[model samples]
Target: MSSLFDPAQIGDIAVANRIVMAPLTRNRAIAGNVAGPLTVEYYRQRASAGLIIAEASQISPLAQGYLDTPGIHTPEQVAGWRQVTDAVHAEGGKIVLQLWHVGRISHSSLLPDGAAPVSSSSRRSEAKTFTRDGFLPVSAPRALRDDELPGLIDDYRRAARNAIAAGFDGVEVHAANTYLLEQFLRDSVNDRSGPYGGSIANRARLLLEVMQAIVAEIGGGRTGIRLSPLTTFGGTTPLDSDPQALYGYVVEQLAPLGLAFLHVIEGETGGTRNPPAAKPFDYEALHRSFPGAWMVNNGYSRALAMETVAEGKADLVAFGRPFISTPDLVYRLSHDAPLNELRADKLYGGGAEGYTDYPTLAA
Candidate 1:
């Protein structure tokens, strides 16, 4: 049986253990959407994880949605991340950046010149986003022209290259939640006609294109992607009508690319592992289709994580909220120690008080 604490090779990066720190967005970026010194310290403190998937960062300025979320598009942002990557590496940890684009889940105030957010279609989401004015309704988005897709694909390609330039071991494209790529994926949201939308093959085009572009830029070994087949954005969005068919095709297409891993959020994100209203979607089917590490997220307990790995259900288990409060989560899990409760407040746009001040076992 594989142990959760055992070393495993994920793509091109070799991790110390199978306990991964899933990406958690903390709106603490400084000016120019650059991760600051505190950001460096925050990651440095949690470097013991087998793998640290750094918080979601926008691929371009226009891709940004929430206030103060970091971006990997600019030179300054790359420099900012260099410090973070260097810090984690010094601790002998492997870290990867999660490339993001929020789509319609953004407000005008967060965009350039108060521009509308863009999406797979002109439909606006009922979702809200964190802005300078606080939580506000997302702005209506303009449908992206087919001609504009190449530039967007190039943006993702560039972001992957920039992540490599910034000293990251690899990059995880954030196609999960109700983000841009997922927006294009879920037929519930994507309402367009062209090469980018319509049938499952068309809907899967943009994500595949983005993946292929990134793989072409940095090679598939250094590439990973996150997917939330049933994450409903807190039930705000409808579940994809045919998740199994859609994601099955997605993984099947990704099989030949040699991706490092596939991070999947089981059930609703940050909620019940088995959502009552959700149709039964076969997660294992997707695993069999891909020839990469299978990283499962969403409500994973230490026991469950161990059992999954031991049974060969999953290769790596990711913990999100637990890692926020317990920087020494791997140690605690291996020792069966209790975890510190998360500070409900100060999750976003905060300083060290709730960000880096969480006490570890050593402290």
Candidate 2:
């Protein structure tokens, strides 16, 4: 029987334990959207995690949606992340960057030359994004033409290469949470008609292409992808007309890629783990198709995580908020200790107060 605290192999990455730190957006990037010393210290503090999926970072300047979030497209940004990976490596921890593109979830103010955010459809999201002006409605996006898709694919490929350049062990493609890929994944949002839209395969085309490109650039053993089949991000986005068939096809398609792992959000992104009344998705079926490690996330308790691992239900368990408030979460869990309270107010864009100020058992 597998224990949650035992070491495991996640593809090319060897983890000390199955406790993972899910990618969290702190919006604390320095000038030019670069990870600074503070960002380095923040990740270094939580290096005890088996695998640290670093925060969602824009693959390009136009990929940004929130203020102060880091980017990986520029030389300065790459150098900035090198510091983070170095720190984690020194502490015997493994880290990977989450490559992101907000698509229609972004505001024009966050884009280059105020370009309208691009997406599978031009229809705008009712959701709001955190900008310098504060949370506001997302701007209408221009439908990405079929011709333009090659460039977008290249952007993902470049980001994967940049991750390697920055000394990361691997990269996790951010295709979840009603973001760019999810915008296309759901029939509720992508209303375009063309080779890039309409059918489920067409809808999943961009995401699959992005994954293939990244895998080719860095190999599948060094790549993972995150997916949220039923997450509406608190109804800011709607569910896919057929969440099961849609994600089912997605998981089946990704099986041959030999990915390192597939990180799944069980229910609502940060909301209920209990499947909603109307939305019914068989997550276990998806788990059965994948050959690599199966990492489960969203509101997991220590007992639940342990049982999930112990029962062979999930190979790894990812914790989001718990890791934020408890840097020594592994130790706390080992001893069944209490966790620190999260400073909700200072979650996004702040100094070390709520970001890295959380005390550990050693403190």
Query: Each prediction's Cα lDDT score?
Result: 0.93, 0.93
Candidate 1 weakest lDDT stretch, 10 residues? 231-240
Model 1, span 196-314: residue lDDT tens: 88999999999999999999999999999999998888655687899999999999999999999999999999998888888988999999998999999989888899999999999
Per-residue lDDT of 340 in model 2: 97
Q: For model 2, how does the per-residue alpha-carbon lDDT over 131-249 read when each residue is reduced to its tens digit?
A: 98999998999988889889999999999999999999999999999999998899999998887789999999999999999988999999999999888885768889899999999
Best by lDDT: 1
Candidate 1 regions with alpha-carbon error over 4 angstroms: none
Regions of candidate 2 where Cα sits further than 4 Å from its true position: 275-277
